[model samples]
Structures are given as structure tokens and as C-alpha cells.
Target: MNALFFISQIIGTVSISAILILALAKLFSRRWRGQAEPARSRGYAVLVTGCDSGFGHHLARSLDLRGFVVFAGCLCPDGDGARSLTLQSSSNLKILKLDVTSDEDVQQAKKTVQENLPEKGLWAVVNNAGISHWAEIEWSTIEDFRSTVDVNLFGCIRTSIAFLPLVRASKGRMVYVSSVFAFFNCLNLGAYSVSKRGLEAFADCLRVEMASFGVKVSIIQPGNFCQATNILKLKTGSDIWEKLDSERRQIFSRQYIELATEYFLSTCRAGCEDAGPVVDAMLHAVTSARPKRRYLLVSAVDRVFFQLFPFLPTVLTDAVFSLSSMYATRTQMLHAK
Candidate 1:
């Protein structure tokens, strides 16, 4: 008993030390590594996708103000987001109607960008267009998974491939705006997580391949900013649940769906509202002479749960998720009663 007690005490001490080390690292980590020569924004062009809203829209305006000739790709060119961006910036900022999922639209966008590029060529391409859908793996259909991947994963790939020549011509950078979901998973986000995870892998390979070409590739992992992006507003758990078949609907009863939707909205409401930090990360990635390979802009909650939790044992992680699921289920049951 004494020996077992001593071993347990040693384990506790080691665990506590590890936690402290991680906390310190996170707290002290610099946003950008090394002092890079300042980037000349004039005459340099950057193409940013998904300017219709969210991170992309904010980033387009930010870069334009910083003197970059900005090509803002809006899925809805005449929409409020695109119009607002155009109204807010000078002629240096041009809005391009780009539907990343459509090949014809991507080609047209490429042509438009080429027509406007200075002799120095395009400086950077920020692949920020993506979509998210919320539904448990068991509840979601293959179509749901495909649609999510189409926008979140394939869209980045499409934009990057089309813009590579421009980026290479200027020896510029490619920045992919991924999510914290790329590194971690959560309930009702299976499709979204899978898509971002694939994007992370794609960025890894592209970074290695582009290294020899004097072009840099960076991935930005932003925390939950659903409010800022309007992602939760675009699609909710209830929206997905309503489309389910009667049999599936019975499995996740109406009461459960309502609770889940409420939970989803609450989480979104709690997410980061300001997109400034994330946009800053993107700017650094684009303009820095020596940008880091990856930037993580997650919140404290994300750091603790997704970042640190992964270092814990699998059983511990499972237990944490399982307990949360149990609580949610119990709450639903009570509500049903």
C-alpha cells in the first residue's frame, strides 16, 4: 500500500509539472518568430477567397488598408459583404466573383487576377473560403460529408492550384485559414472536423513541396469565431436535424434536437467576436519576410481542451467527452419527461 501510494504521488507531481510547463509555453509564445524585413505592400497583390463574410472579408479590407492591391473574391459579388468591402476601400481593392466549388468560376477569377497583376506578379493568395455543418457522424449522411469537404477542403485546394503560378512568379506565400477543429474533434462537428483535418494535411504537403520554389506556405488555425464568421448562423444542429428521415429522427428525438440546437447556439454566442487577431495572423503570414510555418489563434478554452487535452492519455480524453455526452443525454431525458 505504501509503495502504491508513493507511485501515485510521483505521478501526480509529474502531471502537475507538465501542465505548468505547457501553460508557460502558451503564455510566453511569441506571435511571430524572428524579426523579418518589412514587406513592401505597394505594387504587391494578394488574392483572398470568401470575402462574402467573416475572416476573408475582414482580411481583404485590412490588407487593402496596408497598401496591398487586394483581389477580394466574394461568392456573392453584389452582396452586402462585397459591396461593403468595395465601399470601404480604395480602387486598389477590387471584388472578384469567385465560387470556389465551381471550376469555371475559379478559372475566371484567375484570369481576372492575371489581368490586374503588376509586373512583379501576385504576392500572396489567402485561401480562406470554407463552410461548416453540424451533425453527429451517425446522424449525418454521405452527402453532408461530401458537401462540407467540398467547400472546406477542396475549395482551398482549387484556389491554391489556380493561384500557384501567380504566387510563384512573385516568390510569395500561400496562407490557408484552417480551424482549431483540424487538431481536435467535438460532438456534432464530425463533418467539419474531417474537412479541416484534410486541409491541414494538404497544407503540410504543399508547404514541403513549395519550399524549393522560394514560396512559403502557412496554415492559420483560428479558434471558435462562429459569431464573427456567421458560421453558426449559416447552419445549426436544428437545421440539419430537420432534414433527417423519420427513423433517424426517432433516434434523436425532437426534444434532443431542440436541446442540441440550443447548445450549439450557446457555444457560438460564447465564441470570439473580434476577428482582428485572426486577421493579424493572416497579415503576418502574408507580409512577413520569414513567417512561421503555422499560427494558432485559439482561445484559452481551446488551448486547454483541444491543445493540451491531446497530450493526455486516450482514455482520459474519452472519459472527458463521454461525461459531457452523458450529461447532455441526461438533460434531454429530463426535458422529455
Candidate 2:
């Protein structure tokens, strides 16, 4: 009994000490963080993708106001978004038609940027174009996965390769707008999580490779700001269900689909409405002389949970996810009658 009691006491003490240490480290990190180096925005050129909506739109306007020669890439240059942006900003903000998934569009965008750049070349390129779909892996088709990757993963690659020369010439920055799902996988968002994971890897590789050339690469991981972006405006669960064959449809009940759709929309509505935090991170990555490798813009609760995810046991995490899924399924079935 004495030996058991001593072991428990030691374990408790060690756990307490570790928690205290972590608290102190976090406090110090915030208190003694170094300020970013000042950078001049005037005459510096930046290319931002997905300027037709959300964070990209706001960021383009903000940078333009700050005197950075902003090259905003919109999928539809003549659309309402582009027209609205034109009306809002000065002549310094020029909208270019760019479809990151299309090589021809990317090439044209590169050419357009080249024609307008100052002698310093491009100063920054923000890869912000992305899309998301909601459904389980089994419910989704191969095309669904491919489409997501084409925009989220291959799109970034296309843009980065096309603009690397200009960025290298100016020793500039490349900022990728990744998602918090890159670090923590969530239910019904496998494609998005996988795409962001691939992006994280790509960014890490590029960051290391560009270090010798004076090009800085940074990634912004934002959590649940779907209301501020077009992430939740894609195909609904019912739409995908209708397209599925009878066999596949039978695998997932109608009630489950209804519940999933309701859950997803509710979650979107619950997300942060303001895109300011994410845009601020992007601006810092572009303009800061000493930019961070990764910027995580998440709420305090999300931050703690994501930080703890890597340390949690696999079984525990799996169980938690399974329980949540089961609960949702049960609730939906109960109301089916």
C-alpha cells in the first residue's frame, strides 16, 4: 500500500509541475514575443488569388488602401465582385482574371502581372483560392475528391510555380491560406482536411527550399470562419445524395442526410463572422520583415484543443469522434417517425 501510495503521489506531482511549466511558457511567449520588422508598402506589388469573395476580397482592398500595388486575381474579372472592388479601391488595385486550376489562366495572370510590375518584380503572392464540400467519404464520389484537390492543392502548386520567378527576383513572400483542418481532422470533412494537409506539406517544403533564395513562405491556418467565406456555399448534402445511385443512397438514410445538412449549416452559422483576424495574419505574412513559418488564427478554445490533439491517444480521439457520430445518427433516427 505504501509503495502504491508513493507512486501515485509522484505521478500527481509530476503532472502538476508539467502543467505549471506549460502555463509559464505560454505566458512568456506572449509577453516577450518579438515585433515584426517594419516594411514599406508603397510601390511594393502583391498578387492575391480569389479576390471575388471573402478574405481575399477584404485583403486586396486593405493592401490597396495601404499603398501596395495590389494585383487582385478574380475567377470572373467582369463579375459583380470585381466591379465592386474596382469601385472601392484606387487605380492601384487592378483585377486580373485567374483560374488557378487552369494552366492557361495562370500563365495569362503571370503575363499580366509581369507587364505591370515595377523594376523590383512581385513582392508577394497570396494563394487564397479554395473550395469545400460536406459529406462522408463513403457518400462522396472520386470526382468530389479530385475537384477539391484541383482547387485547393494543385491550384496552389500551379500559382506558386508560375509566379516563383517573379517572387525570387524580388526576394518576396508566398502566403498560403490553409485551414485549421490541416492539423486536426474532423468528421465529414475528409477531402478538405486532406487537401489542407497536402498544402501544409507543400508549404513546408517550399519554405525550406526558398530560404536560400531570400523568398519567405508562410501558411495561415484559420478555424471555422465559413460564414465569412464561400466554404459553406457549395453543394449541399441533399444535392449529393440525389446524384448518388440507389445502392449508395440506401447506405445512408434520408434522416441522416437531413441531420447532417442541418448540423453543417448550424455549425457554419456558429462560426466566426468576422474575417479580420485571418486577413491580418495574411497581411503580416506578406509585409512583416521577419515573418513566421505558420500563423494559426483560431479561438482560444480551438487553439487549446488543437494543441492537445497531437498528444492525445489515438483510441481516445477515435472514441470521441465515434460517439459524436453515433449521437447524431441516433437523434436523427429518433425523429424519423
Top model number, TM-score: 2
RMSD of each: 7.3, 6.7
Go through the candidates in order and give each one's C-alpha lDDT: 0.85, 0.87
- Clashes (backbone N, CA, C under 3 Å), per candidate, total 0, 0
| Model 1 alpha-carbon drift over 4 Å, by segment | 1-39, 234-241, 301-305, 310-313, 323-337
Q: Write the per-residue lDDT of candidate 2 for residues 1-337, one digit (tens) a residue.
A: 9999999999999999999999899757955895455447876799999999999999999999899899999999999999999999999999999999999999999999989986566899999999896677877788889999999999999999999999998888999999888867766788888888999899999998998898899999998899888766555666867877888666677677777777777888898999999999998999887778888888987788777776799887666666676566755675665
Query: How does model 1 score by TM-score?
Result: 0.83
Worst 10 residues of 2 by lDDT: 328-337
TM-score of each: 0.83, 0.85
**Residues 1-337 of candidate 1: C-alpha lDDT, one tens digit per residue:** 9999999999999999999999788646633343456459988899999999999999999998989899999999999999999899999999999999999999999999899986567999999998888877877889989999998999989988888988887789999988888866777799999999999999999998997798889999888788788665355556777788888776777677677777777887888899998999999999887787888888665665666765888778667766786466845675663
